[model samples]
Structures are given as C-alpha cells and as structure tokens.
Target: MQRRDIAEMLLLAALWGASFLFMRVGATDFGPAALVFLRVAGASLLLLPLLAWRGEVGALRAQWRPIALVGVVNTALPFALYMVALLVLSAGLASIFNATAPLWGALIAWAWLGDRPTPLRGLGLALGFAGVLWLGIDNASLRAGSAGVSPALGIAACIAATACYGWTANYTKQRLTGVPPMAVAAGSQAFAALATLPAALWWWPATLPGPTAWAGAAALALACTGLAYLLYFRLIARVGPAKTIAVTFLIPAFAVLWGAMFLGERLTPTMLGGCAVILLGTALATGLLRTRRSRPAGSPAP
Candidate 1:
C-alpha cells in the first residue's frame, strides 16, 4: 500500500475510534435510542444534499427494502447496542471488544458464503476470543463489584454489536455491491432515523441537555457518521472490503487515547495487551499476514 493510502486508513481509524468517546459523552444526557436517532438524523440531513446532487435519491426510493434493512442492522441496532455497552464499559474496552468485528465476519462468511476457514484463520479466531476473555477477566471496573454491570455482560454486548457489524459488512458486499456508497450511507441513515424516531420520542428527556451534550451529539452525527461513512466508502473503493475493514484494528488505540485525553481515563497494561492481540487477530482474519504463493524450485507448487 502507498503511504497516502496508509495515512487515510489511519485517519479513518482515528475517526471511528473517537466514536466510542463521543457515544460515552452523549449517552450521559440521552438514552440509547434517542442518541442513535439524533446521530442517524443528523447524518441523514448532512448527506441528503449529496445524494440529491448525485441524482441517487431515486435509487434509494426504488430499493427501500434492502436499504432499510441495512440501515436498521448496520446503523440503528448496532449503534444503540454500543451506546448501551458504553453506559457500562469504558471507552477503551468497548472499542477493543468492537474490534472483534472481523473475527465474526470471517465466521459469518464461512457459514453464509461457504468460504472455508483456513487453519490459521481458525487459530486467529481462537486467539481473538482469548483476548476478549482476558479483557473481561482482568477488567475489574466492568464488574458489579466495581459499581458497574457484570463484566461478562458488558463484554457480551460489545461482541454482539460487532457481530451485527460483521453480518452487515458481508451483507453489503454481496447484496449492495453495485450501489454508490454515498447512497447507501445516506439512505441507511435516513431509514435508521425514521425507525428510531418513535423510540426517541418516547424516551425523550424531561428537559433539553446543555449545549455541550447537544453539540457532541451533532458532531457524532456529522463527523462520526456522515463524514466517516464517506471516508469508509472511499477506502472501500480504493481497497476491497477486507482491507478497508481492517480499520477496526486501529480503533482501540485511538479510543484509548481519546478517552485519556478527554475523559481522564487511565490506560492499563491489560488494555494495551488486549488491544494488541485483537489487532493481531484482525490482521490474520483479514489475510494481512498471509503469504502469497510463489513458484518453488522452478516448479509450480499448486
């Protein structure tokens, strides 16, 4: 990969990693459903003009079923799950757990697409689970004894959210391959906003949040959702889905840094070690560490 592409991937990772921090901040004032609604609503408004400019509005209108399904699974449901997990889990831990999306993607691909899992990939999956287990076992703050929910439950929620993300990743690749990324992003956000509107209304706060909370929500929508999706689509176009999806590996690092900077959270050795293992597993699942075949001894090996 070129240096420029690598830089873009890193930037993408940073933006996504920052999302955990944003969600943690915003969740203090908004319920999970309300936060997700505002996020999708804000992103939809920001991207609507772009969709109209590209004359892709009709495509969304025509493909409402799959578009809405993708929106619900990819944006609404997983975002809400992450927000709920953030309510109990540290930003760094949540991001690290979410990084398991690629592992689940590999499993989903094997089951749904009939893609055989290599031995290395299987070992990578086991190592990834071990990393998650280590995080759960070592993180006292995630336990009920530490004034939080059970550590196991928090970990489960994070893994479930990532599994949803994994499913949607392959789903989009197979079903929505030819569609414009902007359209997919915009339409999905719009649909998610619509789906979450009633829940947001039902759980609406008694009073409005201060400007800080409102601004954070807006930034989550605009920067994290709208702009992030644009960058993600660009990366997907430049490098195929597997390579673009590797950004999950960097999210934990960025998440930990952002939490330390903004939330005054402490970084621990366990967190660092877990993040490393998760990234290594992601590399294996994405085939980043796999060696390409070459002719051996002047004869074809295959």
Candidate 2:
C-alpha cells in the first residue's frame, strides 16, 4: 500500500477506536437506544446527501428489504448492545470483544454458508472464545452487579453484538453481491435510523443531556460512524480486503489509549492479557497469519 493509504488506514482505526470513548461518555446521558439512534441517524444524514449527489438514492428503494435487515443487524442492534456493554465495562475491554468479530464471523459462515473451517481455523476459534471466557472469569463485577448489571452480562451483550456483526458479514456476502459499498453504507444507515427511531423515542431521556454529552454523541455519529465508513471503503478499494482489514488489529490499542488519556480508564492486566490472546486468535482466524500453501507432490514449481 502507498504511504497515504497506510496513513488513511491508521486514521480509520483511530476514529473507530475513539467511538468507544465517545459512547462511554455519551451513552450514560443519551441512553443506549437514543445514543444509537442518533449515531445511525446522523450517519444517514451525512451519507444520504452524498448518495443523492451521486444519484444513488434509487438503490435504497430497490433493495430496501435487505438493506433494512442489514441496518438492524449491522448498525442499530449491535451498536446499542455495545453501548449497553460500555455502561458496565471499560471501553478497552469492550473493544477487545469487538475485535473477536472475525472469529464469530468464521463460525457463522461455517454454519450458514457451508464454509468449512480448517483445523487451524478451528483452533483459532477455540482460543478466541477462551480469551473471552478468561476475561469474564477475571472480572468480578460480573457477579457483583456493580454497574446495575453483572459484568458477565455485559460480556454477553458484547458477544451478542459481535455475533450480529458476524451474521452481517455473511449476509452481505451472500445476498448483496454486485452492490456498491457506498450505496450499501448510505442505505443501511438510513434504514437503521428508521429501525431504531421508535426504541430511541421510547427510552429517550427525561432531561436534556449537557453539551459535552451532546458533542460526544455527535462525534460518535459523524466522525466515528459516518466518515469512518467512507475512509474504510476507500482503503478497501485502494488496498484490497486482506490489507484493509488489518486496521481491526490497531483499533483496540487505540481504544485503550484513548480511554486512558481521555476518560481516565485504567488498564488491568487481565484485560491486556485477554486483548493479546484475542488478537492472536483473530489474526489466525482471519488468515492474517496463515501458513504457506503446500503444493501437491505432482505439481510443478512456479
């Protein structure tokens, strides 16, 4: 990849990492449902205009059903669940769980798409889940219910969110072939806004949140959700999917850093250990760290 592309990839990772910090700050005031609604709505407002400018708004009407399903699974539901998890766990911990999405995706694809896993991939999946269980075992808040929910429950919510993301990856691959990324991005956000609106309204805060909370929510929407998607798609176009997806590895470190610097969230040793194990498993599962392909004995050397 070009240096510019590499820089853009880092920027995307940073933006997404900051999203956990943003949600950590804003979800308390806005409530998870409302915060998520604003995020999807704000992203839709940003992207829909660009789509209209590109004369791609028609794509929404043509593929509304799948797009709506994508919105709910990919954006609205997972986002809200993460916000709920953030209420109980640190941003860094939550981001570590987020990084496990690829592992979950592999399993989901195996079940739903008949993509059988190699022995190595199966081991990676087991390792990833072990890391998750390690974190859950390490956290006492899960049993204490200090955050009004057990930390274990928070972990479960995060796992559920990643599971949704896994389903989303496979669903988009199977059903949305030949669709443009920008069109899917815009249309899905638009429908996510609609899908989450009712719940957002239902659980809306009785009192208005302060300006800081509002700003955090807005940043989560525009910078993290909206612009991050644009940059990510651009990176994929410039650097192929395998290279572009490496950004996921950078995100949790950035999340831990941002949370420490901005929110005074401390890094526990267990969390760090879990992060390391999870990333290792993720790397193996995603084929980012694969063994060389062995040619058949009769095959000629290239």
Which candidate ranks first by lDDT, i.e. highest?
2
Give the 10-residue window scoring lowest on summed lDDT in candidate 2: 293-302
Local distance difference test, each candidate: 0.83, 0.88
In terms of lDDT, the poorest run of 10 residues in model 1 is 293-302
Please write out the lDDT profile of model 2 over residues 1-302, one tens digit for every residue. 88999899999999999999998888888889899999999999999998889887777778878988999899989998998888878899899999999998999999988998887778788888899889878873646444477787788889999999999999999888777788899999988999999999999999989998888888999999999999998888888887888898999999999999998999999998998889888877777776556334665432
lDDT of 1 by residue, 1-302 (tens): 57877998898888888899999888768867789999999999999999999899888887778889999998898898888778778898899898888888888998999987787777778788788778878863534633255666667778888899889978987888778778888999999999999999998878888999999998899998898888888887887776777787778889999999999988889988987887777777667666344224555322
Listed in order, each prediction's TM-score against the native is: 0.91, 0.94
lDDT of 1: 0.83
Q: Give the top-scoring candidate (TM-score).
A: 2
Off by over 4 Å in 1: 1-3, 140-149, 292-302
